[model samples]
Target: MKLTASILLTTFLSHVWSFNGELAELECPDDCDCHYFRVNWVTDCSDSNLTRIPYNELSPNVYVLDLNDNFIKEVEPFPPDFKVRRLQLSANLMSELKKESFAGLNYLIDTDFSYNQIRRVDIDAFDDSAGLINLELQGNPLDDVEGPFVAVKSLLYLDISNCSLKRLNDRFFENVTHLATLDLSDNPLFVINNNVFDPLSSLETLKMNNCNLTRIADNAFSALRNLKNLELSGNNLYETNWGVVLENLILLEYIDLRGSGLTHLPDGMFDNNQYLRVLILAENNLAGLNIQQTIGKLQNLDTLDLSDCNLTLPLSEDAFANATKIRNLYLSGNKLFASDLLLALSPLTNLHKLSLSNCGLSHLPDTFDKFKSLQELDISHNPLNDAFVKLLAPLETLEYLNMGYSNLSHLAPDSFSKMTNMRRLILSGNDINNLEAGLFGNLTHLESLELNFCGLRRPLNATLFFNNFTYTDLTELQLAGNPLRVSKTGPLLPKQLSRLQTLDLSNCNLTFLPPEAFYHTRNITNLILSGNHFTSPNDLKFLELLPMLEILDLRYNNLTTFSPKELTLNPNVEKLKLIGNPWRCDCSVANLWDWANLEKGNLGILEGSTLTQEHVSVGKTKRKKLLICNYDTGTQPFTIVMNKTVPGRRPFLNPQRTLTATNRTWAKYVRESGCEQQPSLKRVVRSADGYVSVISEDGIKMRYAKHGPNTWSAAAINAAVVYVTLMAIIGVAFLLTKKRRAAVRMVVTADKRN
Candidate 1:
């Protein structure tokens, strides 16, 4: 009886398992793949050659369903009693969402239909669905948000970013009273109506970044009294009329208007915002700011981002005189001259961070000694020469110093000697041609050093003079954009910097690389060597040394072919940028093409074949065409020589005459010389043979050869006859003269005889 009972129990367990399996497989269409746990059923029918959602086969108990990455066009029907809480149908071919498409999904809480071809959302689509909490319709062609969502009282987060939203309607968010976050970024929203935010009373965060908004209507945020965070960054608002617009947001705490077209802040702009804490107005066109009157009003202001504001003048002495509680001040990308501006910020003795980059400042005044409490100071993109280095030598309290792009041609021997608390120092984009051996000897506390684009022609071989040093202190180093040609020196960098996380050597004229170039930097995470001329075949072996490298940027190099062996050397590389290389698109490079095709997501080729020519002619004429290498095998190679003629040509011969010979005699002499006879023979035969015969010697020779003896006989007879006739004529002329003289005497004698 016990054996029988065991058998029965075994049978019953088998039946139960089979039943559960069948239930899990139920309601799943034959074309879809489904997996189910106890309460949730996950179906993946995406890209399975389906035309529409198989709603009839959908399980009723499914809570999360993903139909994304498919070719589904329409939503026909769904399970009536389904209890779906989340549905993701992104990246599909759906063009429209009808009102009744999601009718039966009463318990749906989240819906993501992003990255679709959706052009419109019909009204009343989710009118009766009250359980909806989050709706993501981003990455669509939606021009307007006029659908009926008034019934979704539980909606808290709505993302409509990257849409075609041009104008914000007043009643667009009337039904979303409980919305806590609304993201409308990356839209063409140029206009914000006065009553745009009137209905969003419970909104805590509203993002309108990159909306191209040129104007914010007065009282636009008057009704959004409960808004705590407002992001209107990347707009065209040149002026900020805070008294008419922002004064009504009594509960506003954070505001990011950075990258806006604001040139200056009004005197009393923040006078009414008593609870405001964080304000980001960076990347604007502000040349100067005078906030003395309003500083006292913003007692709660903590973080102020004024970077890239084109501030040319120093801060007024009274600007932040009353703002004693301010902490973070981002003033990078300004036109600061020196540390004299520290006098204006002296009242804020508790300030922690300050950025003054791109400010045309060459030196820091000794007044920086006043900011003993300052922790971070970004003085990059200025003209900080050796003078500024001395000025910064005394700041012992500084923890982070960014002096990038400062045109710093030199560094004093002990410039950073007293900066004991310095942890991070950025000196990129400068003219620093050299670094003294012990330049950073005193910066024992330094953790990160960035010297990219510093015009460093040689390699760095400095050692920390301080005896209290270890391999775990320095964590990051960026030496990109330097003209360090020999890569063998790369390994000479302090091996004690074992904790380095990043090393950027891009744009360096590195032609050859040694095997141990990066052998010591085992803990490096990011390695960038883009824009370099790494022509050696063994250059790729450098990757083998960086075992921990995760991100590698090898873009814009001389890597003609991709090698899988080289890539496999760094198996941990997560992000690799191989673009901008002259990758041969031929059979020899077939492996590279295959790899690129297989890993299209990770690799990127330059837009066109050859590197873009940057130095085009500056005149109005069109650019001349460049002869790039031909990839087609059938095309023949040709060369073009641009032999530009000189602006003027020299005269063929000098006009001044060296001899007094007339034109006739010169011609006769040229003919005689060209007859191919000796110069003496030509002079001797000139009178006898006649000038014409000597000149036409070539013609006479051809005539004699053709006519043979007849030609020579005719010439000889004619010459002899002419010579005899000339002698007879001379004799007759002489006798005539004698007869005339005798006749004269005879006439005299005859006259006497007569």
Candidate 2:
């Protein structure tokens, strides 16, 4: 139903939109697409191969002018009269901002000029649009160019990062006093004098990270009296004596000074910052800090990060004595002994999140019973045993835990029964060969479970797998890198996971799956079965089982032809990967013309993604589609015998796109290409046009041109008739199944083989 409705809506919208010369009542440039969206005229000239802005042809009432991702060299003066409030000109080729370039954009409120080659800007370029509130000039080559921001005094946000700025005049920010946020990161400025930022008194957030700075004046940030958030990460601030410059910013609320060369903080480092809440000093030499005097004195601080500081064992018991309000602490990269943890963090009764990952601990301290509110914990990469699971019982309120990469081979039954509020569990990278029955019976609220690379081999029955998971809330289950394909003794999935939306069984070496494999997981929307060995058209039986599946990943599998009618597929599932297999684009491919409205230029191969959250190796650079044909038979002329004309009626996002006999014929394509011939079809009628048309209740059709030579034998005729009859039966069943399933319109890997 969702797929049908989406197609109907796309068809409707496509008809209502046309890009020629006018949009609604406004005139548009020939190279631009003008859309009357909501109450605004949005002119999109991005990636239109524009060499320069079409100042005269653009609509005067364009509310949002998008000229990004173009090759335009410069911005000319705006049209004499315009209402463009936002202008986007990023990823362009402009090298300089000439004077009076934007002299007429009075209504401009926000503008972006990032990712350009701009190295200079006239001081008065934006002088006429002084009311502009936000300006972005990042990813440009403006090393020392200044005075461009002298105008736009009402600017509230300005980003000038990655511009190689090495120096700033004493009065660089002389104007823009109303600026509330400024990002000057990725610059090469070694020092900041006190007089540079005197004009920006209203600034609230300042980011100067990744700059090679060795020293800064003590009063450099004094002008930013109201600054609330300061980011100075990735700077060498040791020469400045623990950055004495930060002492003047009394109203600071969040400070990110991670990776700074800090061995110890002065006793009065944060004395004036009473409102500080999040202090991130991670990746610094924090082992030398007197926690009792520095961080411990911040009574209102709630979050502190001291990870990778090489903290030793047996920290002073009064370490966080006065920091009782701290709620989130991270010491992930430091190796802290289990016995020393309690004494160090026992005072933080309000602690809610703690991360001690990669801490080289073999056990956990009798985790402080006072942490009644701790909700998230990460102790991964530790050599913890089955007994360590018992230590976490005190954290009954823990909702998220990452015990992945631990040294446990077995899951102690009922070990997690006390963590009733558990919502997510990550036990990846272990050797837990079998899951203990009823081990998760108490996790009534669990939603996501990841057991990737756990040496799991499944011949387990669904009934016994989740015998006591009374709750039906588990939505995501990742079982990548496990061998679940030997032989199914029972259903592959459990009923407790009926509501599961995402299931990743990738790289499982699966050859074939039974029709009932997904019988219990009918509600699954995203199914990943990539990196398996499914070799025949009969392997498509899974499609008949998953009615609600939306995205299916079958890359890197041993599959060849994809006849949608072989085994009916849920029209809701759109992408079927046929990459990495020897695709014989024979007459069977023509079968796709009737079911798949294979867009002429769209030959499948679509871009794939690499970002994974469940640690599944989906490193496929591009999702393979059924495109490439065997070069030997690349032009092998074949005849497609159609019975009758069945006009394609699938109304989709592209209403103007349709497959017809007049558009293209398979025989015509074969004779035109210069590929080596394999002659998959007989030569007697090979020259005849191969046209295929299909779709019927239970009947099949084969209509060929009468231009072929009359060289048919009795045996050939019998074989042709038998083949057509068998296909007719399959076609009838296909339509019946699809019609019953859809109750609407029945229209709709990765490897080296493609």
Candidate 3:
């Protein structure tokens, strides 16, 4: 019996040891968390304050590793037999990838080194036995696509986007023959040599979008025989001759030349490209469709986008006469008149989607009934009216229609009754003052409705009317930018729209919302309440009732103050827009800074928070002070008087005493002040010095001086008087004086002579 018991006890002890061993092998390290998913073990060691990998304590069966969102500065050596297949080392401070960094990862198939500070990679950095299939090095400081892909022959997908690569050598992609997809988009490659793509003949997808390429040299892409997709959009190729450059790309299926600065295409531009299916030439300077013959050659083309091409001239009817195979056409922003232009496109019966937004089309003719096969029509930004509704009434097959900004003020009861196949209708930006009860009752297949900014003054009631329609197919409803004021109006929405994932009521003048407003919308992922008058804190309770609200836009409101306690009430609010508000910035607002810092400072959200609180503090104060001082303060009091008497000096102040009596010797003082004073003239007696003095009625004395010396003055005065008297008497005494003087002279002479 003792021997049998010992055998059983030994067997039980062996079983216990083996079970404990398996559990220990499946457990994660003390610093990490581990879980078993299928046959692979996943471990997350992020933010564990780990300076290096604890290889000894880590489970041996771990195949997936996550070291993202950590402060790991360097990559330590891995375990000898570590078999990780996918590794994530993003959001770290790794500056360089050395030769021995990924030595032991012989089975790593996917690796993400994005969002790191890696500036350079040494040659043979990834020269290991690992079979890497997908490598993502985006969001790094890598300036060139070198070194990291030295021996990665099995790499099928590689993304080097946003890496500032200027020039690429032929050998850069020589060994990447097995690479099926390569993304070099968003680089600064201003100059590309002809042989830059010579080694990428086996590449199926090559994206060089927004690379700033001004010119494409001959034979630049002549070696890409198997290339299926090529994107050269957003370049500076203004005068590119596509005949010589893209003539050999017969196997190319998709080509994006949007924003490539090509105004017009030459004849036979795409004559050689018979297999091309999609062509994107939107946002260019092409004023007119002068390439009718060239576009006619593309018989296999299915999609053609010419939006925002500045097409001011009317489209020729023959432009799309041969393009009957096209299914989708985008002609928005051409400022086209719908009546004249749609007449030209009446022949395209196979067109499935048509966009004519911002074309200045005020009305459409009844001839629009020709496009019976069109499933989607975007006629927004046109001044459409109730009369224009008849034009679209024949389009019974339209599944989606966008009539926003159509200036439609009213809707006839049977306006949309014929559109039984319509799934989505966007009537936003219309002057719709009211919607009849059964306006959309015939649209039983409608799934989405957008009535935002319709200027609806009254709230939508009549729940019984909507119950008659099939609301189970409704998925999204947008009534934002209206004047739905009451809070109780929220529950008035159709209750059968339980599948609604998005609801927008932003800018609806909603001061408050009832809890039942979102009771049926608990599954909503996006809710918008921006641009409204939700000033009270209690209004935020509507958001808490939504357990799955993901995005909320509260822009342009009057939320002046916020607290951390208010924000904690809604934990699932991922995206919040609080821009354009009157938020107060003070010490109490510092909690927002802390929250933003903790959230890694997302720019869009932090922009709204910081704009009103921090950025608008000093600016608002300065603006207020400017407003106060802008008014005109009556008429500015003038202390310097005009047309008034002088204040102090009495002599100068009195107009009568302006000149003294002694000064009358120089001149007379004219009384020019008023008509009260009159002047008195008086004669004066002359002295020996020929001086004259005068006295006036007011006792004013005056003196006058002679014109010569003292002796000459008296003699001249006496001689003047004598001369005047003698001159008067000389007329009669002249003859007697002259005779008497002569006789006297003669008697004196005769007596003297005798």
Candidate 4:
């Protein structure tokens, strides 16, 4: 019932908007927030540490006013018929905008003094407000645009980007002649002379990106005749003449010129942009030009991004012979071959997305009978094999196919029998193992199937999705790094995956799941058994036959306790990933301390037990949250309690840190930090304020805090003797570069139990 008529029309518009008692007698001020939105009344004193401007007389239908981030230094004067229509004083400490500074906001239409320390903007400051139409003086220092927009003549969007603007004289937009979107990007303005945007004749979107621009003088955009999107990307614009900067953008439809180092793109430079539809010259240095004579007269060009232009132009067949109506073509990081990608994609016969990924393509010459309106094809990380899957089985209007990593191994059973409108198949990092059974039995609209790192080790044959007839719109199945085992002629998935909804068998060393694995996958909802080897929580009874399981990733599994009968299997499992498990905190982890402090499930732990180098620099930093186990029976035999969070130290010899929570108290500071028997304290480095750094097994020879029995603290023994004399001069320059490594094989075994 349309959510019960959207909850009875939201309780009859919250009782007809409380019959506007003027926003219910508008008193919300002391640290503001007054509601009533649709058609006026919104106060909200942003970040309430406000230092002013809580101006009076609001609710005359208070039209949206949010005095942004406080300590406001001055944007006062409001008190008279204050009719605000959108005004957010951004990050404040306002410095100037004097003259009638928004005199009564004549229904001010949008004004955000961006991140302010604004260095002045007097010039009749919007001359008694003439319906200000979007004005944000970006992070101001304003290197003189003189007379700050001489009265925003119906200003339609203006953001003096970064505001260190170096040039732009021709009366700097004279009087904001109906400006329509102008962001002087970053601003150093190297050059862009002539008619300097002839008073923005209705300038329609122009962002001088990065602005180190080399040149663009001639009639500088010929009066932006209703310019339609132009961003001169991060510029040095290698000798940019760009045919007098694109002749006069005949209603130019999008142009990004990414990274601009342009090696060549002049000839007819987009012959009068025949309605140029999206053209991004990606990371430019157009290797040796002739890439379709730089956008072959853009005959209504539809999306063309020359990816990482290191292109060595060999592509012939008239390159893109007049860009035959290009429909999405990004030559991913080009270095083409295979008949120069079939003569640069057989003239993009209306290509519907074609990306020759990492173009060192191993094959694909038959060029899918001229891409019959190709519908998404990315030859991922190309080195391709499996004869590029029978050369994309003649892409019968291919519906998204990405041969991921592309060193594909086997799939010959009619290799995707003429891609029956395949709906999304990415054979991930292919080394594909086995599967010949009606190979994708005529891909019945295959939904989302990614054979992630296919090294498939048997057992997954429900004819790939219930054979004997037909029914395979397989919903999102990524046999993640396949090694799908448990084979005594039993389980490895496919027990009728009744429309499986995302089932990624992560790092498959998975130790078993026979009991009807996902019993007909009752529409399994996101179940990625992360880095497997499931070690009980009763191995989660194949997720209580998945009652639409809602995300359960058992991250790096070996589970130590999530037991209370695996928390009743699917109490609407709402995301649970026990991070790199080694969990066993005794007494059966007190039944997961109130189900890991439930807030509707989202638990992931790896709190601590060893793995440090900041946990092997986990994913190069950022992934942290997942710590639970509390078990504290006030001491004696049950004490896996940790509260005074730890992980400290950092003088930066780069032993890595960043794990927080500390206030001492971990069992009375580890028995007052005596570091129990320091036989060169074999590595502790603990600290929750209770300190501990017993390290002495030749870590460049050191010792600090040596755990509290006091002695180290002369600035921690002079920062561990300047990080052990800079790791003893980089360990004697890495043992003299490993003794002039000319023939350095090894044979230095010694520790026979030390």
Clash count for each candidate, listed in order shown: 3, 12, 0, 2
> Which pairs clash inside model 3?
none
- State each model's CA lDDT, in order: 0.64, 0.69, 0.65, 0.66
- What is candidate 3's lDDT per residue for 203-267, written digit by digit as tens? 88888888888778767878888888889888878646678778778898998988887877778
Sort the candidates on lDDT, descending order.
Answer: 2, 4, 3, 1
Error of 3 at 205 (Å): 1.0
TM-score of each: 0.62, 0.69, 0.64, 0.33
Q: State candidate 1's TM-score.
A: 0.62
Worst 10 residues of 1 by lDDT: 615-624
Q: List candidate 2 stretches off by more than 4 Å.
A: 1-50, 53-67, 146-148, 241-244, 459-469, 481-491, 506-515, 526-544, 547-754
Scored by lDDT, model 1 comes in at: 0.64
Model 4 per-residue lDDT tens digits across residues 1-754: 3464456556544433443111244534533535444324566666546688756535555766767667888765777777777777777888888866677667777777776888768766767678877787776776466533556788888887877878878877888888888888887888888977887888889888888988888678898878999998989877667877788888989989898777777778878878889999988888887866667767788888888788876878887888788889898888888776777677778789988888887777776788788899888888876656676677788899887877766777788877888888887777767676778777878888888767777646776543654345767888877776564433446644467788788887887676566666667778888888888766667676777676778877877666535546565665566666765444344334224322221122213211123311211211223333332234433222332322211011212222222222111222222222222223433322335544443454234443452523233343444445555655676667677553343323233334
Measured by C-alpha RMSD in angstroms, how accurate is candidate 1? 42.2
Clashes of 1: 3
Task: Write the number of the candidate with greater lDDT, choosing between 1 and 2.
Answer: 2
Query: Ranking by TM-score, best first?
Result: 2, 3, 1, 4
Task: Answer with 3 or 4, whichever has the higher TM-score.
Answer: 3
Residue by residue across 571-593, what tens digits does model 2's lDDT show? 46555555565545454545543
lDDT: which is higher, 1 or 4?
Answer: 4
Residue 746 CA error for candidate 4 (Å)? 47
